[model samples]
Each structure stands twice: as structure tokens, then as C-alpha cells.
Target: MVLNYLFRRKPEYRTRKLLCFSKEQMYEVVADIENYSSFLPFCTQSNIVDQNQSELKVKLEIGFPPIKEKYTSLVTMNKPNLILAKSCDGELFEYLETVWKFTSVPQGDPMTCIVDFSIKFKFKSNLYTHVASVFFGKLVKCLETAFINEAVRRYGRSSTCIFEMTSQD
Candidate 1:
């Protein structure tokens, strides 16, 4: 069976997408979180709360234009990648839990992987959700493009690369 979820807090305007990447790229993406956190548009800040073999706690600042607020979350990144965060813990924390699964492509390329992502939560309000969704789409696209560009600039074209996204629509 396939297990997946989508969570939102309507009036509060907080949403998250749990997307998967190939197994080969799994750890690579995780490792880049700290370095790239500041680069995300709405994310004003990200702090490493704790680190060990099993869990990672992070604090972040989410911005909607000139207004900015803080959020904190603890992720249980043990065997499976689990993102458990709350907006209440920081200056403002809301409950959000997202999980990611990595699967290998057995047929051809060594760099290939399949990812399954799931998320569950509540949104503050529908209006906030709608607005953020529209703005975030553009923001995420730009951020992803920037990420790829940064990778190319740092490593050149010859570097091993595999970037893919799966959608259920």
C-alpha cells in the first residue's frame, strides 16, 4: 500500500510538501539543508537545534513580505526521514509532520532513484493557504532553479547528477 498525506493550517497560512528524491540523492539533499536553508525565499533563518545519529531540531524564520516570524521543529531522521516541526516552539509554532522515502531504480543508471513523500498537518485558513500557494509556487521554482545553477557553478557539467520529482496529480 502507498501511504502519503498533505497537511495545512488554513487561516495560519503554513503548508509543506513532502517530496521524495532518488536514493542516490537522498543523503546529498539532507546534507545540503544547512548550507542552503538561507537561500530559500520565505525562509528568513534556519538554525541547527540538535544533531546526532537519530534526530535534528531546526528553527526557522518564515516571512510574508515585510512581516517575519520564527518557527522551530524537531525531525526524527532515523531509518526513515521524518520531518516533525511545530510553529509554536519558535516565536510561532504550528504543527507540521512530513516524511520522505527513497527507492532505487533497478534497471539502468547508478544515479537514478525514486522518491515518495508524504505530509500531514492543518492550515491556519483557506485564504492564507491560497495566497501562500500562489506565491510559493513561483518562489519554489526559482529556488530550485537557483539550486541547480549553484550546483552547476560549483561542480561543472561533468559532475554526476540526478534530479527528479514525482507528482500524484
Candidate 2:
């Protein structure tokens, strides 16, 4: 079993709600590619290769301790609702994908949003995997918090919010 652990790859995923923030507000925070470095941990650089009305092609350089990786991705969005990203030409990851879905709070209640964020990735090298495992939890929390922080920075503090990891894979 220990030997299998060395070769096995695992996917990480989490879903949480960001209450008191509108769907549009939460969606905007996730879709903004250029401002990632300023708020996202380990995001050293971000570049937009191309963009259109519906999609964006971007490259991001992320460094986590001993590992630094650069990857390009194609991002598409369905306005205030969903954001999808797929890894493009990249050397570090075998596969990397992220999905974000924002749902509005029920009518007659405070304007709130439920942000569901998930990521699935596999590094080409096992060494990267081991290193990532050490920082995985921190990495995930940082990513989620970055968006929430940005929302507060842009919008305002939310007195009502429920944040939790729905699951992991």
C-alpha cells in the first residue's frame, strides 16, 4: 500500500457558500484574471494571451515553496453564474481544471451568493505531488480566502456567511 501511495494521484475539490455577496460580485472576483497576482497566494504572475466576449486565454506562474510552475489556460464564463478553466499548453501538469458556480440567494432574502469552487489536477512528476500534499490544505484555503477578501475589499463586509468544505476527492 505504501508503494501504491507513491504512484497514486488524487484530486482536490471544495464547495463553499459566500453569503451576503451577490452572485455577480462573487463571479467577478473569480473571473478577473489580471488581478490574481495581487490577491492570490503563490500567484507570482498572470498574463492574458487572448480574450473575447465569452472566453479568455491566460498564463499564470505560481510558486509554492520549492516548486514553481507556469501554465496557460483557456477560461470561459457565463456571466454571474459560472466560470470554467482548462489547462492549455503546459509542462508541469498532466491535467488541471477549475470550475466555479455562483448561485443567488432566494428571493425576498438578503442578496447572497453560494460560490462552489472545485479543482482537479495531477502533476506530471510524483515529486511535485508529494510537495503539494504538504501545502495542499493551505493552498486551498488561500485560494478561497483570496476571493472572499477581494469581495470584501471591493464590496463590503458580510455579516452573514457560511463557508465550509463540502467534500474532497
Could you tally the backbone clashes for each prediction? 19, 0
Cα lDDT computed for each candidate against the true fold: 0.50, 0.81
lDDT by residue (1-169, candidate 2, tens digit) is 8645854756576676656788888888898889999999889899999999999999999996786789999999899899999998868888888989888866734467777888878787788877676677788878987888888888877554756645433
For candidate 2, list the clashing residue pairs, or say none: none
Q: Per-prediction RMSD in angstroms?
A: 7.5, 2.4
Q: State the lDDT at 61 in candidate 1.
A: 69
Instruction: Candidate 2: list runs displaced more than 4 Å.
Output: 1-3, 64-66, 108-110, 158-160, 165-169
Residues 1-169, candidate 1: write the lDDT tens digits: 1111122422222222222333544535544557655555566677877778766677766776777766667766544333343444623423455454455666845444554454434445444455554465465456555544554454454654544454443
Q: Residue 39's C-alpha lDDT in candidate 1?
A: 52
Q: How accurate is candidate 2 locally (lDDT)?
A: 0.81
TM-score of each: 0.60, 0.89
lDDT of 1 at 73: 71
